[model samples]
Target: MAEQCKISAAIVAEEKSCVLKLDGYSRAKGLLKNGEFIISALFNVGGHDWAVKYYPNGIKDHADSISLFLLLESAHAKDVKAKFKFNVLNKNGEPVSSYERSDWGSREFVKKADLEESAHLRDDCLTIRCDVTVIHGKEETRVPPSDLHRQLGDLLENKDAADLTFQVGGQSFSAHRCVLAARSSVFKAELLGAMKESSAGSIEICDMEADVFKSLLHFIYTDSVPLLEIASNKGETDVVMAGHLLVAADRYNIGRLKQICEEKLCTHIDSNMVATNLSLAEQHGFSRLKEACLQFLVSPSNLEAMMASDGYEHLKSSCPSVLKELIARILPAEYKAAKDIILAI
Candidate 1:
């Protein structure tokens, strides 16, 4: 016989409740004389308007007593229902007595005699509390965002309906031309325009490695890349992949992919990678990434350490014009302050 197992689930609340309170009951008593009712300030509960009504002297048959009622202050196509709990707090700011209802409506909640007997009133003042949980009515069925992307990703993985093959670094990748053109402007022009590669069934990609091309194709299909966990030191490999992918994104004119790669590279910027990243940023005209790299290296704390990196020499050689600005920033404040004395020497 098979063993039995239990499965459980629950509806987690998506929104919070609204609490309504009424204070200064004593002073308002005299104003609410002659059985006149005083309504509390408007409060919102679950997108509907509501208020508390207090009758200083009881209405109708309860003339010798006070009455309290919770009212729906706004009109609705259907009744706005809620589960509520009412409380009369003591002078110590604790609930002396309470009433709970799973589904409360507009009705008299307390009578004067009951309030006086329970010692809920002090100095002719009383406190009223309402905790409301509005019924959301019904749950709507919907499709999750990941489903479509996952289906496209499945198609890519299966290489189903492949119409083009890309030969990158001795590796062949099968992909659909329609999908590629739809996702990238560069791909659209190369595959659809009067380009030599558009006439061929197979295209050759040089400079970019197979892994980087694969990652780019994965993003084009799935709208995401394989997880590159950034917490471990081994994640450095992933960061390097991101740098290469950033270049691919720029070449292909995939703005979103470029932004994603730039953000990932920014998170992993260090002494060793800053120079390379800055060079790539400058080459690709990535203003944000370039600014971030500059800001990271120009700080007095990191300036000297970053200068020692091997890539820094390459950066200086390739972009010597930027050195003047960097030199100005690297000069210590004290050096500038004592410049006159040095000049005298």
Candidate 2:
């Protein structure tokens, strides 16, 4: 029972003829209705929750997550700023997370304790209220410095996570899981029921490095994931984080996160570690990773190109059979024969 928040949209073209696709139950006292979006604040009041708040018998006016993302992405690169923020709350009308307009801000994470505050206690619902801003029409908008879109585009274009176990600071990770989780929602929407329908129960991620796993968990809940780089010296620019994230993304069928991982991988294609991982990408059905692996294997010079490429370290220990199969797939049909001949000679 709060008043409507009458915040304004900066885009001049949207000043008129905009519909308030606003969900009445939204806690934001005033969520402005405009083109492609009705302004919503992340602060959730107890009354209206989005997770189960269904639209009246299917009126498709308010945008779905993909539509909003597309509308945002379609903005000219220079017009898009590198930052976004939201003000979120839980059921008890307490601060779940919030942010004001800033040049660069990521989605705030809600902790388990915060969940306790949810008025409705829906696992997927969060009390959210906040305005979004786009820096379009400027001489140059602040897009991320790294090329996330390109890496993902390469993988999707080719098909797959580009399967490489990203080792950052010496810790190994599964690239496939990361990409899938990141881009999962997109897949859920686009594929129209292809995602692995979660069983009518909960899921707990298996054994994972605690902090890294937590970071990934955050990514699962919120599409906005913070970038963490493991070994910049060896050219692992967020590969560990991005690689693991891709696997999670793929698992959840989130498309954008997968693309972000692929883009990150493409940025450092020349690095031996990346090439080796790309080789492993195929087993996971990461067509792009498979393709990258094929490209590197084509150049014997690249395979001969080893700078501490402990190629099979993680899998040989944990998944010997799977790794062996991958090796067989990677090597030529005559590779075993050639090895036997060399031993005899």
Candidate closest to the true structure, highest TM-score: 1
Runs in model 2 deviating more than 4 A are 1-203, 220-222, 229-234, 312-345
Query: TM-score of the candidate numbered 2?
Result: 0.35
- Models 1 onward score TM values of 0.55, 0.35
lDDT of candidate 2 over 13-67, digit per residue (tens): 2221111123343443223222222332222111111111112111243221111
Q: Which stretches of candidate 1 lie over 4 Å from their true place?
A: 1-140, 143-146, 230-235, 331-345
- Clash number for each model: 0, 64
Candidate 2, residue 27: Cα displacement in angstroms equals: 43
Leading candidate by lDDT: 1
